[model samples]
Target: MPANKLAVVTGASTGIGLELARCCAEDGFDLVIAANEPAIEAAAAELRKIGGSVVAVQADLATTEGVDKLYAAVGDRPIDALLANAGVGLGNAFLGQDFGRVRRVVDTNITGTLYLIHRVGNEMLRRNSGRILITGSVAGFTPGSFQAVYNGTKAFLDSFSFALREELRDSGVTVTCLMPGATETEFFRRADMMDTKVGTDKKDDPHEVAKAGFDAMLRGDSDIVTGVKNKLQTTVANVTPNEVLAKQHRKMAEPGTAKP
Candidate 1:
């Protein structure tokens, strides 16, 4: 029998990453999933229950060494898909936040992410085939008040995804950006956004968001913002003044803005 297609998913321990992995598994792709936490092993086990091969790697995706470790785990297999979904978030005034935490967010969301994509994306280019799905956010379109750095990183990814797709247009490889809005994930708590109105508000389900992204990647779509509300938000952001947008964001993201 022929081997199944292989997919590598980062941040697969929870949320959208895990759901993306699930989508891959269900679609008959064997998976190599990585995360910065030991929960990855548990996630791997769950994926195995659905059948096909699953290798879980626990490594911090915030550093070169960690991305190297995850890359090493996929040594011989030609990757059919690469889901660059690992990222960190920070919620609070930029000046008041710890520099170390801020740096970690940037490193994970931008530096490390780019390093991994450059490595894996090049391989895909050589083969002239592969799918790359990057998890960006509609937040990229806004000036996030308390979540400035996180949104900034996503904006970079959103722009980068489209640019790379155009550069590789003739190649069989395709790059897609998955721009979801606030999701019901550990992101809010981890980012210290629990006190904000946006964090407390109802959020999109990660599974549905991932499904949209995974399907778009298979279809070679350039980008997808998963929810109707988010699509509207992005549309408005396009024409809104930056100053006004920033103020609106502050209302939703500022600390102590959560409703009773």
Candidate 2:
């Protein structure tokens, strides 16, 4: 990577996205990091300590207007890499979840994601050089049961990443998807999933997951699942019947399943 290259990472206030931004800063890339909360500024401060220019943008990635704000933050600078990692998760039976929360999940995970990719991806194509790392999930491979909306959105992202990769295969740009299993993040609490088995279960380390993803993106690999267990889960999911998968997911995701 060039010493002066610029990378834009969304969902960068905490967890995987923040770690990804740290990786970029360490690699000598100037960064434009964004999240929907004010905490993004604090994350930027930390990234700056890694010795690269860091610009923080706080915008709701669930809306086109917010996406545009992030894009505008990049100004006329060429984007050498883009990490589209903004997403939301909702737990509980799909029908029982609030409609507004469900829409937010869909908008953030799918609509805003695609819109940003469409705009930034085109610019990368015109420049004929760039890399994209999309945060997909192993959850996409199975029926989510209680996490229906979240998993459905991830399914779309997983598929979309591959299709986009093929479309840009001949271009200088490359796309990589990081399909990590659950990790140590604020995700469970935010999603109201703390009472579920999966929420209470041991998870991959955020730093390790981020490193794996950043490495894959740098290598231009098509995709990567961060851990051994996650890889096995994906393999099993591929052959399992949907009905079985749904039942299995229920054991892990159903509310009130956490141990006392």
Candidate 3:
């Protein structure tokens, strides 16, 4: 929230990342935004119009080397905030999906996120004054029959964010997980889920989701669900049997499954 504090955001070329970066810039935080596209440069340019300093880092977070490249760009500067939002999701029945694509999804959504959080979180701990915002998902609460790997990755994120938050509770730093249900983003289209109900249905605006995450992180809340429907779904998931939830999820996501 400081005028010149540095904020680092990943997966910032589009969707929630882009919206978060925009909000950060508007709020006067200097930014280091990273993603695997030249669009990052464009995003930085637009954000700078609001008079915030911005640096663009283009890196594929699925690899350790890429993650290192991003961190190296930060040098020794203390990041006031970090958003580990780099991840990919693949949807379709697991067996019918390409193994390589699944691995990439896991590598990005799980490995990259964990590695960045481990490294950045250590720095934040040493400083004892910073905030971390992780992009988790409602998908993590239930079995995603078709998006097996993607959902599994989010499950790890949701749990990891909480455990890490607990571990850092006494430290001055804060960790918050932003769990959003379906949002209008390129995520579903890129993941090849346009035909799916979850993908095709109207979704929460990306700006709204980003605002919820930004505000929650600033407040140092441990976790936040972005919308009313998402909150209700979270409640239902908690009360429903796993078998029933899994069946419902399968109908929504699994290839060849009949529409509900």
Candidate 4:
């Protein structure tokens, strides 16, 4: 509610992360934004024009060094919100995929995000105030064939957010998970999935998904699925057998599956 509460958004270089940073700035939050790309400087400058303090940290989020860079940017600021939205999407047939790339995905999406959450959440707990919004994906609920690594990383994030939310109940620190379905983002292009059905298809807007998470975090909801279609898919996946869900997912995510 303050005019200059501090908000830190990771993966703030592009896509959903960029939108989150913009939303926070509009809502009057001084921002500590981190991203791997050199372009984040432009994004930070744009936000600064909106009348909020802005600090941009450029670091590769797939390693400890990058996470440390992000923390160092925040320094001792008492953050009011933390948006752990940095992530990567990698799609490749399991057997033929590059193992190193798979590790990078896991490192960035799961390990790096969690490390930031741990540091920020502790500070939030100590201050007895803060909100955390994590970006998860609908892909987490099903077994993705070609996008296996990305999906698994999201599964960890979604599950971790739920558990963390419960643990932080009554602590004045809120944790919210934003599980978005297919969304138009640079993610697929970066992941080399531009030719896939899930990649090239019409998708939800990243701004919409960011707004959903922003609003939900303010409301202190534990988790939210952004789209109606994604809500239904989440419900069905919850009740369906894993095998059947995996088969369905494979149709959309596998590199060699035949479409009807």
Candidate 5:
């Protein structure tokens, strides 16, 4: 990548997204970081301490307008890296989830993500350079009993990233997918998953997961599954039947499972 090149990272207020932004700043990339919450400003401040110019944009990436606003912040600068990590999750039986919340998950995780990629990827193709890292999930490999929408969206992303990478193989631009398992983040509280086993269980450190992903993106790897346990989970998921996987998911994600 060029010196002082620009990189845009979504969902950058916390967790893996925030760490990914930190990695970019440390690597001396000028950054445009965005998230739906006000904390994005604080994140930008922290990133500035890392010595790179940072711009924070508060945007709901679940909508086209929000995605447009985010890109507008980039102005005419060429983005050297794009971390399409903005996402939302909903936990509960699919039928019991609120329609609005469900729609938000779908829009943020699938529609908005794809829209951003389409706009940015085209620019990268024109320049014949740039790297993209998409945050997918191990959950996508299984049928999530209580996280139906979230997992479904990740499945789409995982599949979409692979296909996009293949199509761009000779284009000089690279696309990589980062598939992480459950991690210590605000995601559980935001998703109202605190009552589930997976939410309460010990999770991977967000920093480690982000490092794994950022490195993979820099290397132009096709995909990376963070954490040894998560790697094992994905390996087993490949051969497991959907029905059995769904049952296994229920044991961890069903409401009240977190109760001692």
Candidate 6:
């Protein structure tokens, strides 16, 4: 809300993360953006043109070292907002996928994410002023038959975000969760799901999703699902049986389900 507020956005190389950073830039917040790829530098360059300082950190945020590196970049500077949107997804049966890849997904989506939150969160609490936005997913509600590990990690994030919100309820800080359905992003491609129906299906726009998230975070709402369809999907998931959900997911995410 001030001229020099700082916002930190992770997984900011592209997609929803990049859009989120753009939102911060447009809102007049200097930014610290991170991604494991070198592309982060390019993203920073793009944001700088919009006005305000933009620092990019190319660190493997799935590791403790990486999280520490990003935090060090902040170096005692007060973070007005922290957008924890760094995460990865993996597709296919858990037993058949590479274990290393699966581990990376877990580490990136949960371990490192929580580590960063713990660090920034304490500072926010100490000052009693800050906003935290966690990028969770509606996929968390179902048993992802083909995307087992990725979905499991999201489930953790969705639940964790709420519990943390409650703990910090009376404080000057607020935590919001952005739960979006499939969107136009590199996610499905990176997950090697190009052949799946969900991967190829028309989805929500990243800019819209990011705007909804950024607005909700500023408003300190509990959570937001980006699209009308997604809102309905998650609501139905709440009542659907896990067995049924898993079957439905298989239809969308199973390998080679993409229409020919």
Candidate 5 lDDT for residue 90: 91
Show model 6 residue runs off by greater than 4 Å.
1-3
Cα distance off (Å), candidate 6, residue 194: 0.2
lDDT of 2 by residue, 185-207 (tens): 99999999999999999888999
Q: Model 5, range 133-239, lDDT digits (tens) per residue?
A: 99999988989899989999999999999999999989989999999999999999999999999999999999899989999999999999998999999999999
* Candidates 1 and 3 compared by lDDT, better number: 1
For all candidates in order, the CA lDDT equals 0.96, 0.96, 0.90, 0.88, 0.95, 0.96
**Candidate 4 stretches greater than 4 Å from native:** 1-3, 256-260
Winning candidate number (TM-score)? 1
User: What clash count does candidate 6 reach?
Assistant: 0
Summed backbone clashes in each candidate are 0, 0, 0, 0, 0, 0
Candidate 1 lDDT, tens digit per residue, 1-260?
A: 99999999999999999999999999999999999999999999999999999999999999999999999999988999999999989999999999999999999999999999999999999999999999999989998888999999999999999999999999999999999999999999999989999999999999999999999999999999999999999999999998899999999999999998
User: What TM-scores do the predictions have?
Assistant: 0.99, 0.99, 0.96, 0.95, 0.98, 0.99
For candidate 2, the per-residue lDDT at 243 reads 100
Give lDDT tens digits, candidate 6, residues 1-260.
Answer: 55599999999999999999999999999999999999999999999999999999999999999999999998778999999999999998889999999999999999999999999999999999999999999999889999999999999999999999999999999999999999999999999999999999998999999999999999999999989898899989999999999999999999999999
> lDDT of candidate 4?
0.88
| Model 2 C-alpha lDDT versus the unseen true structure | 0.96
Mind giving the per-residue lDDT tens digits that candidate 4 earns over 1-260?
54569999999988899999999999988999999999899989888888879999999988888998889888877989999999988887867888898888999998898888888889899989999999998888988878877888899889999999999998999999999998888888888876667776679999999999999999999889999999999999999998898778776766543333
- TM-score of model 2 (CA atoms): 0.99
